[model samples]
Target: MSSTKDIDALIEMMAKLPGLGPRSARRAVLHMIKKRALLMIPLSDTLQNVAATARECLNCGNIGTSDVCDICTSHKRANGEICVVEDVADLWAMERSGVFKGRYHVLGGTLSALDAVGPEELRIPKLMTRIADEHITEVILALNATIDGQTTAHYIAGELETRGVAVTSLAQGVPIGGELDYLDDGTISAALKARKAL
Candidate 1:
């Protein structure tokens, strides 16, 4: 058996994580090994705990350790407005800016006909229900500016308009094909503040 088999396996697994290459993964594993007590052990325990308890929020599709995420359960977030995002990362990005006071709705992905994805595949139906049940007055479409994202936003806007809810989208600060997770806090705030009706 290879002497470094376990370490190599760990690097391989880490390499599969987003934005990590094999070389970066190896460096990360080596760093963790050098700081085993301070970083590796605690990281392992935390990862295991999160893997065991993490789940999608039943109400808004955010990931959390419970069936419903903290944001969805917070009464203070019930401001009759919902910011719709393509992923949980985007939702977290918006929250980090601390500009929006309303709640969020995470659409797992955009409508992609080429990829065979449709509204039914995402959380659109649930959003419709939330609009009615929560008496939502406005829905802010914070989707990315990609083709699929824009298509999904338009579809959602049309749907909400018929329900008498005002729909708006982030301004042109977001470059085409740029994702929310990549934008800085100031840019997110600017886009949101200058949002236009859809």
Candidate 2:
């Protein structure tokens, strides 16, 4: 009986997206419906096209419309360094920062003992192979600050110990523009420990 059942279903589906809640999804759905010709149709077409063609890159584990993503195929990015990340989302975040010029290796997910995830489950084996095949000189770990993320980073560092490649991790400390009063004890300690000459 609800005449708006299909619209309700659409709102529910949109709510399942990362940051949108039910209220936001409803607003979005209504807005799209109001702008059906201007916004909804183009978005629907693009979504359909992307859903049909999106594929993970075989070389770097990045999602694209091809087997190998543009980053992996770009010669300018072959800087003998590979930034290792936990997921495609992490890889995308790093790319958006525009700081790292080298290629990347997405592990798919961090090693989780509780979840029964291991190196085999991730792309660790592929990473090791890439080190040798691509003549990689350095590997920068950009995992999250969570317990599982740190555990996975340590494990990867151990694995790369004998691989003749320099292994480093992203700096962990106070964030830029963060106030000292609002900072955690661990963060303050890390910032002090990593203090520079300036």
Error of 2 at 64 (Å): 1.0
- Model 2 steric clash pairs: none
Model 2 Cα lDDT, one tens digit per residue, 1-198: 253879989999999999999999988998999999999999999999999999999998999999999999999999999999988989989989999999999989889888999999999999999999999999999999888999999999999999999999999888989999999998899889999896
Query: Which 10-residue window in model 2 sums to the lowest lDDT?
Result: 1-10
Please give the distance, in angstroms, between residue 35's alpha carbon in candidate 2 and its true position after superposition. 1.2
Can you give the TM-score per candidate against the true fold?
Answer: 0.86, 0.96
What is candidate 1's lDDT per residue for 88-190, written digit by digit as tens? 9999999998999999999999998799988889989999999999889999999997888989999998887779988998776776788999998877887
lDDT of each: 0.92, 0.93
TM match of model 1 to true structure: 0.86
Top TM-score hit? 2
Model 2 alpha-carbon miss at residue 112, Å: 0.6
